[model samples]
Target: MSDAAGTDATVEISTDGACLGNPGVGGWGAVLRYRGKEKRISGAETETTNNRMELTAAIEALALLTRPSNVVIWTDSSYVKDGITKWVAGWQRNGWKTAAKKPVKNDDLWQRLLDEEKRHTVQWRWVKGHNGDHYNEIADDLATSAARNLRDAP
Candidate 1:
């Protein structure tokens, strides 16, 4: 992340993902805060998984940075947090395979996330979903609403 943030500007981001079903309409959202300013971004997919949407939220959040930054990301998905912070190196070393010698699901999104992450110092923090966290709640609402809109699209 040294290259991602040439200066010392720090950004706070909260991200969440939602799906109508495990492999159904999905959406992702992120709220980015920097120096008292906030920006919200969200998108939906007609067919996707929750994990993909979660990963998309992170990737999109990082992609929004115009410059390198110290980014602290809050997420509710352990799969996202652990996969990036803990298991990514192993997966990469094994050529994107899991410990059980299985092809890693959502490897494409993982690669995109890694690519976006390289441009910033990213710290992933996991929060419990559906709790009272304000930022997380907003992000969750954004995602769930987007997904629902797409699910109910005419």
Candidate 2:
């Protein structure tokens, strides 16, 4: 990977998640590419929501970075992008309640993502899912494959 302009080093990661059912088997996938090398990571949960898998993809990707660097994270989920960039602080201040005064959903995963994000210089980028973007497509494929594998497992 190329160094991001004005930055000493950079890593670009794309992530996606899939669920066989909203609260059923799910999988998360992430592609972490840097310094001309690429790594793909994925996992499956027997029972999970799509949003939870989405958050897991991001959390796992960031956890792979051992040191701080300028990082660009690409995802198709606006919930992830906006939740981290726009709403997390307010939620934290509100003791994990939404602006509507309801307890935040998936606060555990959100908190994990927040912790991982704080360890790096992160830029969140949103892409349209199922689009032709190469990395995003790969991530999506990996997620779907993982989910399928889980579904097929005895």
lDDT of 1 by residue, 6-66 (tens): 5666799999999999899999999998877889999999999999999999999999988
TM-scores of all candidate predictions against the true structure:
0.94, 0.94
Q: After superposing candidate 1, which stretches have Cα over 4 Å from the reference? A: 1-7
Relative to the unseen true structure, what is the C-alpha lDDT of residue 149 in candidate 2, on a scale of 0 to 100? Answer: 98
Q: RMSD for each model, in Å, please?
A: 2.4, 2.4
Candidate 2 per-residue lDDT, tens place, 1-154, comes to 4344356768999999999989989999999888789999999999999999999999999888777768999999999999999999999999999999999999999999999988778999999999899999999988989999999999
Poorly placed runs, candidate 2 (over 4 Å): 1-7
Lowest lDDT 10-residue stretch of candidate 2 = 1-10
lDDT of every predicted structure (CA atoms): 0.91, 0.91
